[model samples]
Target: MAKDGRGAPVGRRVMLGVLGLGVLGAATGSYVQNSYDNLLAQISSRDPTGVTGLLPGGGGFRFYSVSESIPHRSDQDYKLTVDGLVDRPGSYSLADLHAMPSTRLVRDVQCVTGWRVPHYAWTGVKLSDLLDKAGVQPGAKALRFTCFDGVYTESLTLDQARRPDMLAAYRMDDKPVTAAHGGPVRLYAAPMYFYKSAKWLSGITVTDHVEPGYWEHYGYDVDAWVGKSNGRDDDPTS
Candidate 1:
């Protein structure tokens, strides 16, 4: 009788031990499934169309498709020409540009596709200063910018072009830009996404009205504000 009673309690203990193991297995399975789902969600998520590609440092960088790539020329070969509508249509070499007063700014670089890198340091001449030197005409309501990438072009109103935030950048992060990064010269429009900052930039033609650029013609908003334009609901980096 004592042996029977002991067997009954042992049997109950074994059952409880098996039940605990089952519960633990179920919990572990649920945790693994949830973790897998979360990883899949992150992997499957797509960036918005026209968004800039990621850079090496875990920072977001944007690329503008230009018509043609202009090889980086030395100071002797580099010539920035101003033609279109100006009194003193002239050409400037790299040396001439370097001689001019320089301005340095630190601003967030926003991309239309939904990425923003803050505090990118840029050093260059002000667009307004250049326009002033070129002596833009009274009829000039817009400015068309051309790049070495023969396919890409951008246009901005005179008011927009003259904004303090607009820059004809020569350096990024305290160093000269490289060919892979639109070097020698590039437009830097801090208020807009990096695409608006045309790479391999060459020409600035002042005109009477706005002209849609490459991306603009393809349905991108002309005025690509950080959070307001491009059909994005993201917050502004600025």
Candidate 2:
């Protein structure tokens, strides 16, 4: 069984600060409250436990990042790069992605760290669809995802990337994805553990083989299907 190095002890001061901000947000409900949400995001960027993630984030989903901070990208500045083994190499802005065809899915989001958020709504362009548009090369056998945070990366086999359930999701919770939730765009691998779905998605580079993601390098399974990998016997999310 693979055990992750995360879940380290966070500070009590951080929790107390969050709680205080939550009270302030409730009491004020002004710009300060909005700022509180942003402050929580800053705190959660360094939080491996996802405890702060459940507080300000929209869904029950918890936030975790390998980077020192969560990145925020706007429509004008955010771009998803498609390159590597593809015939067409280019970047797509948030507007370009929003104009493309979108598929909606409602599925249980199960995390490897013993958390479950059921029947969450996800909407985005299918990964296979994006690959087709980019014209994957004959030599391509895998996909490597790089995030805007500059630390996290994930990979999938070509067959797995082509699954109908795999998506480059731009929307969740029936609204635009917030930065804490992986923001303007993120990967949604419905059949796998939530960690397999990389957040703050920035680049999708087609490759000839799969490279282990950050967690995978730390003894997590590269193909982290729910209830299958990590030696857990929980209900299958797929």
Candidate 3:
């Protein structure tokens, strides 16, 4: 077993056969900070075949970061840019986001890999609020999300992006999101599969058409509805 920063056992790393390499053994604790560090190493060293999704979260939900290593941005340096086909394009600092009215929602998180965390509470500004502030231009059909992580991207149709359930999330389960868990801020598309909620979210661009996201480019569905998009019939989380 690999121990965490506080010397708690983080269970074991599951270096299974090719189809399941880099998965993690179930470990639970609120104090095991280094578990994410070990799991992040495993992710960078293997394929993205849903292996990282198995890494345990001390707070009940699992953690997954697809980058070669987790990236960090201090709150002082972090900014979210909203642009493309918009009239009032603008950049917002972390403090700017915090000043916005907050919306909190309790929704289920369904990962494409067959894991579901029901009733996860997320707190953030509504995506529609930002889009409205930017004054979306005519002919904008979709919204694309780019991450500070450098590799992850996700898109949603204009209608989907404006839904009340969609948010630019800054907190999860009532706590400020940590770096290992896509901190500073992330997107939360409550009705879509978890992947649609891009982590380390940095940009929101209005697009003329639906662009495939990172996983979608790798054959996952671009419109990742909870149970309908990816060939799985699990119950819808929204």
Candidate 4:
């Protein structure tokens, strides 16, 4: 139901298969960009890979997506809907988000799967500000984030969602976020595992209770704090 990166409305693409990163790059004609789109485009244009985990960073870190093909969106056609259990439901365009006060977080990005990318920088609007702007209603105890990718979803309790470090991010590493990296915007949950920060972010629904998200439903902890929730003793990221 959302538009692709080229501004054309498209259905959610499913992950069908995965090819080796080396073969993917060679067949696709260039080294995979650190972003999501180039790699996904190569996959979509050729074969499908259920490549949810990607080590495009020369093994320094990993980039991942659950689906084989990624959804794309241009800022001009991108829209974010904040609704469900709010007194003042709102829909925001990319420009509207850019005008808001932004917060920058330089925190370690940890994946529950055991890789870490330290001191990555993210820039975006505070989720708390957006909730306040929408006038969140009483009994809304959790926030559910739905991504344009169609298969991924994540949640946070009201307290976690309001953390000053949590952001609805549009920029990463001092540059505009690319499609491969979950732009025009994505969520950044600094204290939680990387999966808590959903990419291709599209909808925010306020709910009366916390519903376990995509990975949580599959055995990952719903409250995915870096070292605490997943039973690993890694140092905390925040």
Report lDDT per candidate.
0.76, 0.87, 0.83, 0.84
Off by over 4 Å in 1: 1-57, 62-70, 234-238
State the lDDT at 238 in candidate 2.
Answer: 69
How many Å off is the CA of 238 in candidate 4? 1.3
Clashing pairs in 3: none
Q: What is the TM-score of each candidate against the true structure?
A: 0.72, 0.75, 0.75, 0.75
lDDT of 3: 0.83
Give lDDT tens digits, candidate 3, residues 130-189: 999999999999998999999999999999998999999999999988887788899999
lDDT of 1 at 89: 87
Question: In terms of lDDT, which candidate is strongest?
Answer: 2
What residue pairs clash in candidate 1, if any at all?
Answer: 66-149, 67-149, 67-150, 67-151, 67-152, 68-148, 68-149, 68-150
User: lDDT tens digits, residues 121-198, model 2?
Assistant: 999999998999999989899999999999999999999999999999999978998899998899999999999999
- The C-alpha stretches of model 3 lying farther than 4 A from their native spots are 1-59
Q: What are the per-residue Cα lDDT tens digits for candidate 4 across 77-154?
A: 989999999999889999999999999989888888766676789999999999999998988899999999899999
Q: Which stretches of candidate 2 lie over 4 Å from their true place?
A: 1-59
- Better-scoring candidate (lDDT), 3 or 4: 4
As a whole number from 0 to 100, the lDDT of residue 96 in candidate 4 is: 99
